[model samples]
Target: MLIETTAWGKLEIDEDQIYHFSKGIPGFEDVTEFALIELEKSSFAQLQSTQHESISFLLTDPFNFYHEYEFDLPDTDAEELDIKDAVSVRSIVTIKEQLELSTINLLAPIILNPLNRKGKQVVLHKSSYLTKHPLWAGNSILDKGGE
Candidate 1:
């Protein structure tokens, strides 16, 4: 299918790329459909709303930036998405004017069930992660041996 996006203009996307968000993203509760487009040679992907051309999010695999990043997918969430085997996790990224100041929202990760094309932004209620973590903060920790 073809969709218009502010970032990429008109583009062709596959049916498998489209995901259905039952509860939608945090603030976009009404928009239930989005296409997950991966950026070549980059860890980032664009979650573009199929309905709204301008409504899109920059997402990245938190693990790419933070190797130690871990979370438990509540049983309820797993069942809701009908996740049987394949699952994709991505964090919303906020890019700043100063590239180094970019932050990623680790507290709430976008989870996708590839098999069913279902998605959700699951909030980690018991996690120590914050909504905005410096995009490159993990480098310092690794540089200091996780001190």
Candidate 2:
């Protein structure tokens, strides 16, 4: 299927690459369907909304930057996504003017059930993580923006 995007322009996507966010991402509750496209030669992937061409987010495996990153999937959320065995977790990447200063959201990671293509951005209420954490230089929060 072909979908229009603001970043990558019009591209063909496979059905398997699509994920359904029943309650939608935090701020984007209206948009539910998104295509997870992993960029070539990169550790990041784009969660592009299929319904809204302009709505897109860059995602990355939190573990890639934070080896110690850990979070327990609430039983409620796991059951909602129908996550049985196959699960995927990703963090939303926030790009900054200074490329090195970019951050990824650790407080709420995007969780996915690859087996059923269900997804959600589950917020960790018990974690010490913040909404913005440096994508590199460990998992410490260093945003001067005071987020």
Candidate 3:
């Protein structure tokens, strides 16, 4: 399974590594298949669209930046992915950068099923969350506490 990517160029991916997003990411409902590729020695990953070479997202675990972060998907979403246990769930946030700070889309997290290679970008209904939450600001909070 060889495919061309926006950032990684041409690479080989296992068929099993291909993830099926029945309802693709926001603004990309038609794009379904994607493969997760990690950036070398970095916490970031590229969610490369198998359907479109130009369509790829930079993603990371929000928890890595914000320890207090939490998200809960609706029961309907869980059923759609056939999710049974928490162990099968992996969450990633789309990265965004501003002039002052770097942010992550916490309101809509990409959830993946490692075993079945299925995924979904779920929009959380919680009011406390934001589409662009500052990941770096969260770290600054911890630093202030340490001081």
Q: Pick the candidate with the highest lDDT.
A: 2
What lDDT score goes with residue 74 in model 1?
A: 96
lDDT for every model?
Answer: 0.90, 0.92, 0.74
lDDT of 1 by residue, 1-147 (tens): 999999889999999999999988999999999999999999899999999999999999999888999989999999999988899999999887767667888999999999889999999997999887888863343233321
Better of 1 and 2 by TM-score: 2
List the candidate 3 regions with Cα displacement exceeding 4 Å. 86-100, 138-147
Superposed by TM-score, candidate 1 places the C-alpha of residue 91 at a distance from the truth, in angstroms, of 0.5
Q: Please, what is the TM-score per model?
A: 0.91, 0.94, 0.82
Give me the overall lDDT of model 1. Answer: 0.90
How far does residue 132 in candidate 1 sit from its true spot (Å)?
A: 0.4
- Give residue 92's error in model 1 in angstroms: 0.5
TM-score of 1: 0.91
Better of 1 and 3 by lDDT: 1
Most accurate candidate by TM-score: 2
Span of ten consecutive residues with least summed lDDT in model 2: 138-147
> What lDDT is reached at residue 37 by model 1?
94
